[model samples]
Target: MRKALLALAITGVALLGTATPALAHNVLISSDPADSASLATGPAKVTLTFDQYVQDADVNQIAVTGPDGNQWAEGPVTVENNVISAPLRPLGPAGKYTVGYRILSADGHPVSGEIPFTLTKAGTGTPAKVDAAKASGAPAADASATSSPSGSTGIPIWVWIAGAVVLLAIGLTVALRTGREPSQEKTKQ
Candidate 1:
């Protein structure tokens, strides 16, 4: 009886834990070249990593713009697993370059942030002379679909409470059933 009570309590706790939403897209896990990295040379590419796998086609995008406000990204964004990368078009003038990205989360919302990297000396390739306005396309940078088939999970709170109550009643019945055994034993004695 005691063991059954303990088992039911453990099950209840586990179910309660599942009631809360999972951390699908809350924190920035990591980035390639790291945030605030001071590199003596300009990187050929920029990559951003997330806590979960991000899709390439739909929501993931990266845009690299120089301090001069000129967009220097070489081509379309590439996504391999959780990492997303964009090419650099001859980085120019030593300064901070902002890597702006937006990735679609597994849960269906868009997540976006900027990573700053400084170039100490100078880059071999001169900055692309493209106008900030001409580089017109603001890459969406969405990485993944935040809401999945499971994201549609919906259950009333009262239903959960009622289920818990039903389980508790069953557990109590098992615990009290032992009292009947003792009464039978007393009569036999």
Candidate 2:
């Protein structure tokens, strides 16, 4: 019984040690236009800042939607450490504009949310040519899906958890077997 308990305790400590670092996802710290901001002129670029480094992945996406329900984000998105930015083609028909983003978090998860701001005045800027798929407000691929530098699928958190569980089971089995032998000998004598 004591050996079994010790095995469980060791397994618990190992699991906690390995799981702590991957538990936190990136949090949005700030933005260029700010959430719920009211602006007279549109920002040339939209920037989102996070509490941790943003993973530089092609799956990272940012979309600026105007009040007219059109995409305003122009050019490719850029990720620099903890900040993600995208150019805008200017905003038109002032009202509310939402900046939606799906970024790969530093911890390998995908963090997605929107920042809404009101455009107090309209500017003479046309929306970007919308792609049929992107217009639907869904990412091209699962942002959470990550690949390693060697082009291999990264090990997911679930796998690690499963491994830990398996290890615990094995340890418990070994401990219970060894614990039973001492009891069996005592009973035989």
Candidate 3:
């Protein structure tokens, strides 16, 4: 019984140690347009800078929504040296442009947010036309919905706790079985 209890305690401590390092997540440090800044001209590209290195995955995305609710961001999002950026197709219908981005953190978790910037003057460029069905589709929208808050690493805390509980149960079972076998042998002697 004592051996089983000790084993379970050791397992619990090991789990806590492993979970501690995974608690830190990438945080947004700054952006190109600067959140809520009023600009005379549209930026050529949208850039997001994070405090820690971000994962360069194909899943990274950036969408610029103009006043007409049309998507203005162009090209695929690129990541380099903790920075994620996407080109713009010239902005039109200047009013408020919302920049929404979803990037994978270094630890394989998605982080997303929106930055709103006002365009002081209208641009000559036209907004990119997107199909209503495709625009409202799953891929782009799901990334933001799936992301956890800033401080959270990725998975929920309960997931870690449940994993630790399973490990403790296994350790206790093994320790008790081994301890019982030795006692049984000694009694037989």
Model number with the top TM-score: 2
lDDT of each: 0.64, 0.78, 0.76
What TM-score should be assigned to candidate 1?
0.58
lDDT of 3 by residue, 158-189 (tens): 77788877877887777877567566788999
* Higher-scoring candidate on TM-score, 2 or 3: 2
For 1-189, candidate 1 gives per-residue lDDT tens digits of 566667667667756665443335535688766899998877788777777676555445677767776666766678777777877766777888777776655554456777788878766675554554235344522213232334332343566577767766766666566435566778998
Superposed on all Cα atoms, the candidates' RMSDs to the truth, in angstroms, are: 7.2, 5.1, 5.2
* TM-score comparison, 1 vs 2, better candidate: 2
Question: Best-fitting candidate, measured by lDDT?
Answer: 2
The CA lDDT at 151 in model 3 is 40
Off by over 4 Å in 1: 1-23, 124-136, 139-189
Judge candidate 3 against the unseen true structure and give its global Cα lDDT, from 0 to 1. 0.76
Q: What is the Cα-based lDDT of residue 42 in candidate 1?
A: 78
| lDDT value, candidate 1, whole model | 0.64
